[model samples]
Target: MISMFVTDLDGTLLKNNRYITKEDKEALQLLNKKGVDITIATGRSDREVQAVFKELNITGHRISQNGTFTFSKYNENVFSQVFEEGTSLKLFDFLHAFDFPCLISNFDNIHYAKEIPMAQTLQSLFKTPLIYQQDLRNRIEQDFSTSKFMLLGETSELLSLEKKIISLFDTDVSTFLSADMCLDIVPKGADKRRALEALLNQTGIKKQATASIGDGFNDINMLAYTPHSYVMSSAEPKVKLHGKKTVQHVYEAVDDLFCHNLIL
Candidate 1:
């Protein structure tokens, strides 16, 4: 009884870092017609996720900001988590000491601490526009809703920073490393699973009745919580280990769901 079909967008559903396959689009349409609710869960912001939704013609629930926020079909913000102003300022100052570029997201926009090569590369890759700020620390006092912070650099540098971040923030933040170079730091209390739980509470969907497919460290909690979980074959070994099953493509997961009634 798969009441909800939640999937991560980037490495899982979007092939080649750009688009979803025609076959997957059609399969999701059919699954929705069959009474299965489809949800897009990702580390993307609301605006970033909207681009994918527009491409897929999706107007369902969304778990965005890596679980910092959730939105209903009407584009209503049903759940959200934000950094306290003091914490935001503290983190901003701490991260600013690094020469590496940092990217911060308000609920509506993304700001870059500086115009470094890594930030420019990520801006091009994610295709999300950003406002470069030389004094990002000061901007944190402007009362904007700050949700997530990210740093992209060499893997070794990111790993070292990850350790430092954990030691400094302790349990105050959640960290995810992906693509070998990007580290995402969000509030510890929020995640894809937490947002999904909120959605389930509102919709009365049982955890076991949910199906999820993803291929990132941030997707681990959501994948582990659902009974029917699929990881992409291309995922990193660490990510693949957390999934109950693995599929080569999104269409394969859909085929298993609709063709074979594989909800278990």
Candidate 2:
């Protein structure tokens, strides 16, 4: 029987990368009524999760920036980590050579350092406001630590960048494709599983009592970490095998878990 459930946003929870469905709302309400703790683990920022919580009228734990940060249900930050200034600058320099829309993100906001004509579109796509910090290096100079670095571009470019990142910064950072065209880079050893472990230790939820669902490469570790896991049906073929089962909606996963627990 699972006492805690963790899910990723975007493609998983947010149907079609947009809004939550009525069924998802019902599932969340049902989980709450059943006294099951909920956690949203995603590559998105905390504010985005809070926005979803606002829409659902629900709150749980949040593991954001691909698990670089973890926050409790009470809104207290239990654990957090970010790229050091030197490393961030080195990455920033490497990223600047590419014309792909680059972003520097923190726990608070997503930022753009170069001219991006499609800024408005990206803002809408990211579901968050994009702040322009003409010089990201300067921001880092102000005691700033970046939560993640992002690049949105063609698949070819992203593929090349992924290889470059792996070859150049293999031990310095972790990079993965969060979406079809979006590649995200975070501090080394940071991932959903590591962050979830921090949350579990604080909340006293054992791995056996936890279930998670996700549909992205960044979610692979998380799906593997939790004993009971689900993969979204719409996810890439390679990602589906990580979960014990596949579901198209959050409610279905909840229902399956409830049945396993003999609660239904």
Query: TM-score: which candidate is best?
Result: 2
lDDT of each: 0.82, 0.87
Tens-place lDDT digits, model 2, residues 74-126: 98888898998888888999999888898888889899889899887777766
Candidate 1 residue 250 Cα shift, in angstroms, is 1.0
Task: Tell me how far candidate 2 lies from the true structure as C-alpha RMSD in angstroms.
Answer: 1.3
Local error of candidate 1 at residue 147 (angstroms): 0.6
lDDT of 1 by residue, 128-234 (tens): 78888877777788876689998878878988988998898976888887444678888888899999999888788899888999998888888999888999998
- What is the TM-score of each predicted model, taking all chains together? 0.93, 0.96
Clashes of each: 0, 0
